[model samples]
Target: MLIGYARVSTLEQNEDLQVDALKAAGCDRWYVDHASGAKASRPQLDKMFELLREGDVLVVWKLDRLGRSVQNLIELINRLHKMGVGFKSLTEQMDTTTPGGTLVFNVYASMAQFERDLIRERTNAGLRAARERGRVGGRPSKLTHDDEVMIRQLYESRTVTVRQIADRFSVSRGTIYRAIEAGGVAQTEN
Candidate 1:
């Protein structure tokens, strides 16, 4: 049995290319998801893993689409191999059933890890430079002190509902609640 897996990081991304490639590759069954690789849980990936069995072949459009990290990808592939399942990545020309293909997969995996490490290194360096320049990181405050005061006053008066308060502040109810919980607003005595 040949099972295909396709994924796109977001809904805005089109899966047509991967889907077409998988179909052309003669996939008998397939799964797909529109979810970020950073997310640990993906419904379609979970389903595909569950449905795969011994002697079955799992095909993917690309390896990165299957996993975000080299460790995770290695673990997944090793698990499948142990289960007597075969794997293939169309774009990478990787296949688990052959020795040469396995070597290629390993090399690509190492390269992927290296690429990720470089990205992290560059990001940290950039942040350090920005900090050295006296630039602050993270999001600016959504509400000013004046806004907090007004929010507290409104909440104490009980003239407007929490939802109304959130609307007036242009923030979510959860954000409003967090502000109140974090002592952003004055507390009213019961």
Candidate 2:
């Protein structure tokens, strides 16, 4: 059985073209979704998956209509394969039930992996360059070194309570405790 799936980004878009294509492709049953391809949840698509059985072929008007990204498309296709089901995309002319189609899909998978590797390499290089320039990522410390030193002194003198120190620094008691701890001050009941 060729169960078709079609999707449009919005309800305003017409699905007639996709419907016609699916019908012409000999789809036995079809489902339509009026949701963004980026969205993981689609009621009609979920329903179609639930109804799919082994030996069933999932058909779509276009590959993009069925997945958000190349990685997502690969995952969906792999999932269908694992279930003993096949996949076909009308626009891309891809059919996992055929040997040639499987080879093409594998090429797509490799390309997606290569793209991911390139992105990771660029990001790491950027991070390294930023570090060389003395630039660090993450939120700046709320308390400065001088502030931590003062907090440690106040805490050690025992003249002010931890609560008082926290109020003076306009920070939480936990922050004050951390500052004192950094200065080798043994924690005591406040």
Clashes per model (N, Cα, C within 3 A): 0, 0
TM-score of each: 0.60, 0.77
> What is model 1's C-alpha RMSD?
5.7
Query: 1-190 in candidate 2: lDDT tens per residue?
Result: 9999999999899999999999999998999999998998899988998999999999998999999999888988998999999999989899889999999999989999999999999999999999999999777879999999999888889999999999998999988988988899899978
* Model 1 ranges with Cα > 4 A deviation: 1-50, 60-79, 181-190
**Every candidate's CA RMSD:** 5.7, 4.8
Summing lDDT over every window of 10 consecutive residues in candidate 2, give the lowest-scoring window: 137-146
For 61-129, candidate 1 gives per-residue lDDT tens digits of 998888877878887898898989999999988999899988987787689788989999999999999
Query: Clashes in candidate 2: how many?
Result: 0
